[model samples]
Target: MLFGSDPGQAEFDEFVRSRAQALSRTAYLLTGDAHLAEDLLQQALLSAAKAWHRIEGHPEPYVRRILYTQNISWWRRRRFAETPLDAHEATTAAPETGDRDLRLSLEQALAQLTLKQRTILVLRYFEDLTEAQTADMLGLHVGTVKSTGRKALDRLRALAPHLEELIND
Candidate 1:
């Protein structure tokens, strides 16, 4: 039989087909660059594919865990210097028109945060994961997640005051 004929492979394929878009978005949020996000998601999926048969009913959490930890690991190795959004980039955008401006501002604000803070915020807000869930995934204490999330939000507020309303929401 062909590799695709395997039940596990079929299930994995279906899961990817159904969830790739959402997963890709999550990856993009984790990594600011679209190309990096694609690579990150591909790596996570490959890891998942290897363990498909061992995975229980749903594989999203497992894959996401991989994505989250993998991102931290990659960040640690790259140790890229953080750059703040320039005044021109921040002020030139017209926020009144569309989501593009808000998105740019948020991305810039998020970029300013340390990796740990950014990861905490992304998991807490973007993923809608509970503190317990996030802590479990990151192997951090729930209190740590809560405190970091609060600090990240506070820092974001300071960096981009215009995002206050959306941030609170």
Candidate 2:
């Protein structure tokens, strides 16, 4: 059946309408670029739509699992090169807000880390998932999650000591 004609499709559409922004932010954190994040989100949503009947109401976790794994897969394939943000470019692109510099610094620091490290930090701290939950989500061992999270935090601290609350928290 076509979309909008079925109740399941309507539910799915409503979910997307309500959750797209949050999901896009997660995707942007994973990909580090708005355009790439949109692509990643589109790919994940396509997969989710395919399995919509199976997942039904609880699609967030299922979709997030796809985002985490798909990001790792993309890194392994190396479809695009990872580049650190240039200081001038970063400053120029930063929005004119109270914490603009701090946010830009955090973004730059995150860009410096490897994809795995960035993903770990994003999942553990940004998403507020526990080590075990992050490990399960990423198909990693709990110890790996713990060690990686510590290392990622250390790296973040070294990169931007001014953001102590962000790193220590």
Candidate 3:
């Protein structure tokens, strides 16, 4: 049956379950807050549910678009008021000591970036999206994506100088 058919709810639920963790990671990277990430994912899923009939075949891209767009909208609403995680709070669960420190520093650095820059970094690195794919998802040109990625990287470098050492290591 087509996505718009009577059995659409099951398909939609399956899709959400399969993609929830990826979406939550992306949302967490975007918002830098676990609670906000859950809220963002909930909002994106709701929007996706509304458009399920039209997007069933290409669910990943459609859902990613919804996630990115909803994240941007949330940023525009100026509702992000949480304080950034402190150094202690930025710790990760990695077993490798070096990796844990790097992850914490990166998280701290990411939190300092503007919403646009943070989103670009998440799309580029966390989601493993190409510049073109990120541009399409973000409704920006490829050049803009490239430039934003550069700027975001630069800011990250400034915020966490140790990242360069980590990168080199």
Best by lDDT: 1
lDDT tens digits by residue: candidate 2, 42-111: 8988888878888855789888888989998987677367655443443334233357777777877787
Off by over 4 Å in 3: 1-5, 79-96, 165-169
lDDT per residue for candidate 3 within 41-159, as digits (tens), equals 88888888887877747687777777789888877677466333444554344333577667877777788777887898888887888999889888889999898789878766655
Q: How accurate is candidate 1 locally (lDDT)?
A: 0.83
What order do candidates take by TM-score, descending?
1, 2, 3
Determine which window of 10 residues in candidate 3 has minimal summed lDDT: 87-96
Per-prediction CA RMSD (Å): 2.8, 3.5, 4.8
The reply for model 2, stretches above 4 Å from the true place, is 1-4, 79-97
TM-score of each: 0.84, 0.83, 0.76
Sliding window of 10 residues with minimal summed lDDT for model 2: 87-96
Clashing residue pairs, backbone N/CA/C < 3 A, model 1: none
lDDT, each prediction: 0.83, 0.80, 0.77
**Highest TM-score scorer:** 1
Which pairs clash in model 3? Answer: none
> Would you list the clashing residue pairs of candidate 2?
none
In model 1, where is the ten-residue run with the lowest total lDDT?
86-95
Q: How far is candidate 1 from the true structure (C-alpha RMSD, Å)?
A: 2.8
Instruction: Give the clash count for each candidate.
Output: 0, 0, 0
